[model samples]
Target: MTIRFAAVSACALLTLAACNRTQEPVAPASAAATPPVESPAIPAADPNALTAEGLGPVRIGMTRADLVKLWGEDSQPNAVGGPDPETCDEFHPAKAPADVMVMIQNGVLTRITLTRGATIKTDRGFGVGDSAMAIKQAYGGAIVAQPHKYQDAPAEDLFAWPHGGATTYVTDPAARGVRYEIGGDGKVMKVHAGDPSIQQVEGCL
Candidate 1:
């Protein structure tokens, strides 16, 4: 009788231990009831008449009249033999050299020439032979091109200065860099520092 009682007590204790071991743990109330966090609000940018960078405002497809309104008159036309009547051409006045060359056709702006000493700012990626409208689409305004001479292999080379009286397009005057050159033939000739001077044709009709 004593052995049976001891065995029954041992069996009861083992069952209790097994029950405790298999019980599920309770999660903290705080952790289970937590809410999601919200993000902070960002501030809006300031508006100004001039650009944030302090440069003047720029627009694309601006007409000759519109250009005159924005930049005033050109200092002087760069085209030799004075301005051409067949083509509308004007230079920004000395006070506002940024205007550069404004070319027009049938009273509509056709092309623009950026001289080496202008202040007009542009973002369009303009190259030589690009019409005024095309140039404005890529770059808003004209830029200066420094004085540079090309050295081609044959005297009859396309870029030979006098061949067509090359029109130098200054892409970044501040950097003293020229983007392209338009020959008299109205074709763009590559004029960079490389052998066989005329590298490739890059321009717009």
Candidate 2:
């Protein structure tokens, strides 16, 4: 025939160019589409940022942004009177002494009141059930106590005899002043001296 039909059309055009060079090279669907990578953003907390070693390690589920990252706002919400819970809100600290409250509620935190003389239980001078090493062996260092800041009670300090008379007749230790209320599980619910409702003693050690 015409040279076997032109050599069977040049071997069927070299088998369609070797089957399009073994196919499979078509990417470019936007180069196999790929675009997504971005994440970083989390910052917003400063309600009043507190401290006193951050209110001595507060506890109770903590939140209101962790009490504004440990107290910073200067705390102020107190509703009307006090005693907490109307949803709660009371945090005064102008230098301290609004009876030292800090209740919070929906935002978390429950209570904290280091008022009434600011804590000093007893350095041996006896009062809230006596026996601070037996009142430091019956008044050795000449006793003179300190610590005072009362509002609703609890958190006291005040010893006497810096030449004020009366060594320990049993009561009237100068008009008395030794409180130390620290509840919320931390312990020390109440010690007494004068007006924690007239001697509201409690455990100690």
Candidate 2 runs further than 4 Å off: 9-13, 16-20, 31-40, 44-56, 59-205
Q: How many backbone clashes does every candidate have? A: 14, 16
Residue 192 miss distance in model 2 (angstroms) = 21
Error of 2 at 205 (Å): 25
* Candidate 2 structure quality by residue, lDDT tens digits, 71-103: 544445443423443454545534433344444
Full-model lDDT, candidate 2 = 0.40
Residues 120-154 of candidate 1: C-alpha lDDT, one tens digit per residue = 33223333343333432443333222223443322
The TM-scores, one per candidate, come to: 0.37, 0.22
Model 1 TM-score is: 0.37
Against the reference, the lDDT scores of all candidates come to 0.36, 0.40
**Ten residues in a row with the worst lDDT in model 2?**
196-205
